[model samples]
Target: MATHRLTELPADALKMIATIAGPVHDVEMVSAGYNSEIAARLHLDNGTVFVKGLRQDHPRVWTQQREADINAFTQGLAPALRWEIRKGGWDLLGFEDLGGRHADYSPGSPDLELVLQAMRYLTSATPPSGVELKTMPQRMIAHVTDPADVRFFEGSTLLHTDWKPDNVLIVDGQARLVDWAWASSGAAWIDPALWVIWLIASGHSAADAESLAALHPAWDITPVRHIDAFACAQQRLWESIARADRPDEWTHKLHAATQAWVEHRG
Candidate 1:
């Protein structure tokens, strides 16, 4: 989908944003995401604010609302939500501009350590009250070969399953996570397990990636049985996605990596 610049927003929508964000003197479209139709930084007199949205009629329109809801509970982990608006046939959200670079997880990089620190802190967080999020077990029920493997992921900790380098921002020597579309409630260990795949993709050996993740308390204490279950489940899930009618190159790469990780588990 083509991303829309702020100037492209209808006059009413621009007025609504200006009201909440101060007079917008400039607009810069952000090209990092795939789903957003309108993602930009509005330069107000006071400061820059990040905005992301999509057409109201889009099939995944509900994701914008979900991100807003999740943002309310993401105090320390993600940028704060400045406001949410549904105007001019669009549903948009404004967030505090976290001026930082995306984290790098390659071997010998310092950013990986900071990311682990953030993940450790995240494991201690309780989900905010009154918000509905899918449980990891619920989300993965269809992917695992054995029904019992689902129990391995049943827990109360909030999980950030997507660990691509693009989702983590490094600022002030700390790693701040972004993109809450896939946030779910699950065992704390599940997040570290998910990161292992990205770590490998970043050129770390499987053993080294496991070692880096082991620095987290959650990863250290994860039961061997549970780890085995999750490994097999992820392999099955990626296999199905990569083998689907017409899989893309990225999907095939991930499928192969997951398969290697599963074999490494043995």
Candidate 2:
């Protein structure tokens, strides 16, 4: 559920963007993103830069810094960070305008292969030095049935836990991940585990989605009990999300998908 822009960018914010990226020839508000108070495409005199930001006082403002800090390490897997500005009570980031469509995760879709390729590339990434990142166990601590299950999630691999189709773009026959706000340092198998939920939501059954996830090399080495614990944790997490005030249809769909996954794992 994306929050739509309710007003134009503040004058001071626009001025800061101009200073960093040259004059803004035009502004096109991008309404597809869930996070950020402002998401827009700035058509600059030099080039187009996609910018997303949040007011300094916003509760999730820290995510703006997280995305900025992780962009460099993402390398070819994500859009390059062009510039960043923290001014006029706002934290803004400009990124390379990757003209790409959201990836298709439907059964038999060709984009699935490219998405796996991107996942393979992501497997080798280690968190950048000096950047603090949450580990899988830390993030799922509250959701797991047994505290000991958290041990199954520990690893050094950098993970992109959010694999929504919109977060992955199909560009030039490659899948590029976006939105590193929730990036975590976790087990290599965890990324594919998270992706399996999205695949089921997009029409694949639990078994089918898992078969696809098995394409990742990490999947083979992960213990079944570890994945089972992770699936239970996901079920609890999505259940809470779905119960929130005015939860969106997508949230409920994912909850259903998680329930199916947990059942299949049993």
Candidate 3:
């Protein structure tokens, strides 16, 4: 999903933003979002707020509500949500502008530690009561090679299943997770397992990536077979993604990395 400039927003949407955040002096369109149609830093008379939104009729528009509902639980590990605007056929969310660069996931990068710290913090979180969340098994059922492998993905811990570097920002020595669209309830070890693929894609070998993931306490307690099941599931997931679309370069890289990890597990 390509990001759109603030100017491209519906007139009523802009009016709604101005009404909520005061006059907008400038707009800096964000270039790093996949799920948002409008992602920008809106400079208002009062202050700046990072706003992201999608048309009300978009297939994934519900993600806006998901992010809004989950923000309370992500207080320290994620930027705070300030306000929400639903008007003119769009659902926009305003978030505190926590300025930071994406974390470096390459081998030996110091940012890896901060990323792990953020993951550790998330390991203790449980799904908020009354807020429906997809479980890992539900999300991965279609992709797992064997239906029985789905059992390995079940658990009650809250998870930020997407570990792409772009989703993690290193701010003042802390890694703040952004983009909660794929957040799920899952086995704690599954979060670390997901990170292994990103670490591998970012230049770590399978052994090194798994070693880094092992630093998380959950990884040590998870049975080896469970980890193997996840690796195999990831391989099948990426392969299906490739077959479904003309795989992008990064997707190819991830697919290869997933295959490597699966083979390493075997």
| Number of clashes recorded per candidate | 0, 0, 0
- For 113-172, candidate 1 gives per-residue lDDT tens digits of 899989998988876667778899998899888898899898999877778787899989
Best by TM-score: 2
lDDT of each model, Cα atoms only?
Answer: 0.82, 0.90, 0.88
Question: Across residues 116-182, which tens digit of lDDT does each residue of candidate 3 receive?
Answer: 8999999889999877789999988987778988998889999988888889999999999999988
Error at 44, model 2, angstroms: 1.1
Give the Å shift of residue 117 in candidate 3: 0.5
Write down the RMSD of all candidates, one decimal each. Answer: 2.5, 1.3, 1.7
**What is the C-alpha lDDT profile of model 2 across 188-234, one tens digit per residue?**
99999999999999999999999999999999999999999999999
Estimate TM-scores for all models. Answer: 0.91, 0.97, 0.96
Clashing residue pairs in candidate 2 are none
Candidate number with greatest lDDT? 2
Query: How does candidate 1 score on lDDT?
Result: 0.82
| Candidate 3 root-mean-square deviation in Å | 1.7
